[model samples]
Target: MSNTPRTLFDKVWDAHVVRQIEDGPSILFIDRHFIHEVTSPVAFLGLQQRGIGVMFPDRTFATADHNTPTINQHLPVQDPFSANQLKALETNSSKYGISHWGLGNPKNGIVHVVGPENGITLPGMTIVCGDSHTSTHGAFGAIAFGIGTSEVEMVLASQCIMQPKAKKMRIAVDGKIGKGVTPKDVILYIIAKISASGATGYFVEYAGSVFENMSMEGRMTVCNMSIEMGARGGMIAPDETTFNYINGREKAPKGADWDKALAYWKTLKTDEGASFDVELKYDAADIEPMITYGTNPGMGMGISNKIPVAEALGGGQASFEKSLQYMGFQKEDSLIGKKVDYVFIGSCTNGRIEDFRAFASIVKGRKKADNVTAWIVPGSHIVEQQIKEEGILDILTEAGFQLRQPGCSACLAMNDDKIPAGKYAVSTSNRNFEGRQGPGSRTLLASPLVAAAAAVTGVVTDPRDLM
Candidate 1:
């Protein structure tokens, strides 16, 4: 190890540092490859056409989540498109000799969810996924990024991916988090304050007191939204939280290997005097659970704040105004009392064991609102089983939440599950773009607690109040 102080990113980058070209990005050595139903099909076909195969097949893992149905995993998928895609992923992975964790497999779930659950994501590694939220894996101190279909083919054919170096930004959130606040709120607040484009062209590194203290799930939530904040990727340096989380995973190095890995992982931290291209800071206690009042992720406010006026919206004012008109919302209107058509509490962003526990805590013993339709999907099949084993399902069902099959249900309109046209849905998904949930369906992004609170009350209520 070099005596130079290294950030977690520096450690991982140096470990995977293959070769550097003069004035060009270093050739990165990818450690793990994650596959989902949506992006693997084309990449597989590309490989077939080239007569190539997955170079490091075991390093690649496949799961159908984005388009997999949250209901009836036992039965055939309800949507024809989804059914075909899931089937194709299974076939493609099988043909290529890659491990595909299909629905019903103990490890199957969202690509992002399964990677960490099974210890596939670890410190000092490079990870990539086809989904933009692939940044979620960076919480383990890995350099994780989302890739295009073509690039997926490149990685499958050769474990190395060509990439340009991204400018770096360190977003420091220091201080204690306020009650009723969460990492979800922290990211939402970051996006709101910085606006959606604040980190554009940069790889964001989350830092400071609040981030350092965040749980693995919270760190995942922070990194998950890196893309939304206009960064190519987001990362948090690994600490004891990261090490403990990876200790017992199926793919984690074991025994002597684990000891060896830990020695290396301990070095994955920012040096005290290292300089970054950009630096940002925020007070952790100031953040609160936020809700989107307009079409984009940035058009959000604390659950207590009213919708923004056009003047306060900056360059996106016209777009924000248009989205409000589309969603039938008006400026100065409060979001809490809006009638909700659906409440969705799972996504790559919040569909984890911790997120479910939090949601269940909020809704336990409460009856689901008669007027609200709710779906609670886990991030992965392992998460689903954990929920059942922990009796989380019973608590959820009694409280009027159904435990849906593991998949990216309602987060995107790719699967059969979708909010009907013009209906309002409070979702835990990351994006709030127009037609994100479905054509003309309005989405208000919030944390699982907020979504659960909305489900029981038939309106958006702050969970902090109920808790």
Candidate 2:
């Protein structure tokens, strides 16, 4: 082996490799496996067909998110199909003795959100889920990413997966971020700069002052979008911030165990002089409140800037034109005064308590625009409780907004929260792909602050203007 220093990704990856196949993928061990309703059913079926028991049930966690309705969750799931999926998850979890936080469980919420809150996510571990936003766990310095149904089954049966190593990348953002900028803006800006495929074939580690100073929630928001940039996953080195976030979590280690874990966690950082296959840096000040104007996350611009002229787009003119057409926009159109029909302020990307606080902050003294329908869904039941306990719900209610129950509402068109056809929505979700929120629906991905601004103004207004 070479005597080179190792990046955080390198160190974590190396420690998790069970065995190296000759000229092939390594047998990588998974320390934690998270499952959700949308993808776990097939994997669990495969296990039943193979008559295999889960190798280590304690290491696996299951939750129902994607298909669960945001409201009326207290009653039976109204949609039969969604109910079936949730039932399947519960059945499989029970059959396999895996810990499950089903709908209405106090612990139930988005898998990504629940994992960190419960401390199921930890530093120096390998974490995987069937959802692409599994990168959210990487914010705690774990090597986390999404997997396919087959890979999920493999992990369930064997606690390991065959994986080729990914190249390492470092994205460093320095300097002070300006007021009104949130972590969602930081990621949207990065995707816009690098394009959606910029980090293909790599695992990125976010460094520099901006990420270092970011809150755990903020770091999670940034890492949650790593897949949009085509990176396998993204991570940040564990620090005091990470420890503090994990310290008192429900599932976090206790007493002596905590001390032992803390010592190891402290060591989970990139070594000095380590090299990456690729490196990119940006000034945090250069990033502002951002919004996507096209069908892709990379098609974003600062709230103060006009949309790009078609001639300036990277993809072929035909596709670029098609995307703009889908969004009912023309090249060089300014989004500033564009009418917005809906505002969504919840997702795994921005559905935490922090996100709600940001939304409430913007709309505290303002009324929701009558023309704009706003859906404020939290990511989990815990977050919902926190919203009420913190009086954020009261602020939202006084602002003419209702707090919806927790679920992955409107982030995708999977359930009852879909946007109507041909309507425009400013969403805080990770994706802005055509029809992602609903058929014929147009989504503009943005931060919770930006979405809040749109909710109160009925237009794409700069959050800074409201501030």
Candidate 3:
């Protein structure tokens, strides 16, 4: 490998682009593209209005997810908006000669879930999607980020995107996590410390002892929320966990090709003397079980801590006060004991099989709280199948948890799984924006452990308490 002070993002990005313009952004060649049912409609419509077919049909992939119900994914969706959106995607893909995996297809699932599971997401590639959490695919040492509809149109036509090289931020967290602390906690703590807009317009590269020891699932969980911190994307160097996860998948390279892939992946890490635009350090031991108390995601505090008072609001006091009024919360209230009407565990963020296993572990022997309604939706049908194969479904069912169909259910509430207005919900999904769960619904973002605890206790409680 060259001794230039290069990072993984630099390597992958340079390898994918054809040329760099003077005083302009690099035009990166995209190797893989993923599209969901929700965001592709407008982009595809733009393509049709201009009478242009997708330039590289082989590189573009489509899936009927995001709006497909987790329970019954059969013909005729229950939500008209969902059905129309999915149908539009199907028609667009067919006309544009692009491949699409629909509801009944074995490969169908959430766009991000299917990409990694099918082995299409690999190191040293450029990935783009219209959905913000598209950063999830960057776990494989790829340069991945979300784009606007117009940018999507640009990508579908040229298989390349005009992109500016973002400033890179290095966040290093050392030490081991305490028991019951997961990657979700690590990210929430980072966001809470840095605030939601702290990393805006920057690419975040996570390092140090904690990330080095993390599994691929853990890495994905961190990268998936890069946007939550206002980052363009987040990534970690490709390692054994990442390579192992890619190996043996349906679309992964095999035999000699696999050896070649691994060799190249091994080269995709930061050079010893590499410098970043910004650097921050964290102590993993200092992180706590965090919960959101306001509409925006950054309004978070430790579970055992009470909400921030006005004097503690810092510069965002006005916005914080507005958020409190919308959520009907008091400044001195403890997030730990807040009553919840619903508990949801799933999303591209925490909807993987490992997340389900984590939830099942905590709630298996107990029953759901009497007044709480809980829905556990898987990220993908593949995740759903894994839960069944692992017998996690039975455990959740026995504990009075309903296993909902795979989709983004209640994550953004584009379907019928919305929490009623004035009712509180604890969710594992990323984002806690105003009406993020539904129009006028209140959401408290937490980790899967916290969601599982709320599922059993009917209130926002610390997972440490449950343990």
The lDDT, on a scale of 0 to 1, for candidate 3 is: 0.86
Clashes of each: 3, 0, 3
User: Candidate 2, 114: how far from true, in Å?
Assistant: 0.3
Write the residue-wise lDDT of candidate 2 on 1-467 in tens digits. 44778899999999999999999999999999999998999998898899888999999999999999888888998889988999999999999899989988999999999999999999999999998999999999999999999999999999999999999999999999998999999999999999899898999999999999999999999999999999999999999999999988989999999999999988888888999999999999899999999998889999888888766756778888899999999887889989999999999999999999999899999999999999999999999999999999899999899988888889996998989989999999999898999999999999999999999999999999989
Q: What tens digits encode model 3's per-residue C-alpha lDDT throughout 344-448?
A: 998888989889989998898999999898888888778989999999989988987778777788988887888888889999989888888888889998889
TM-score, model 1 to reference: 0.96
Model number with the top TM-score: 2
Q: On a 0 to 100 scale, what is the lDDT of residue 403 in model 3?
A: 83
What C-alpha lDDT do the candidate models reach, one value each?
Answer: 0.86, 0.93, 0.86
Clashing pairs for predicted structure model 2, backbone only: none
Off by over 4 Å in 3: 1-3
- Candidate 1 lDDT, 1-467, residue by residue in tens: 57766565666676786888788877888889998888878988999899888889998889878887777778877768778888999898888888988977877888888889888898878999888899999888889999999989988998988777787789999988887777888999999988888888888889998988889998999999988888888898889989999998888999999999999888788888776889998887788889988777878899999887978766666777798898799999988778888998888899988888888888898999998989888888778888999999999878867788888878897887888888889999898888898888899999888988898899889888899
- Reference-based TM-score, model 2: 0.99
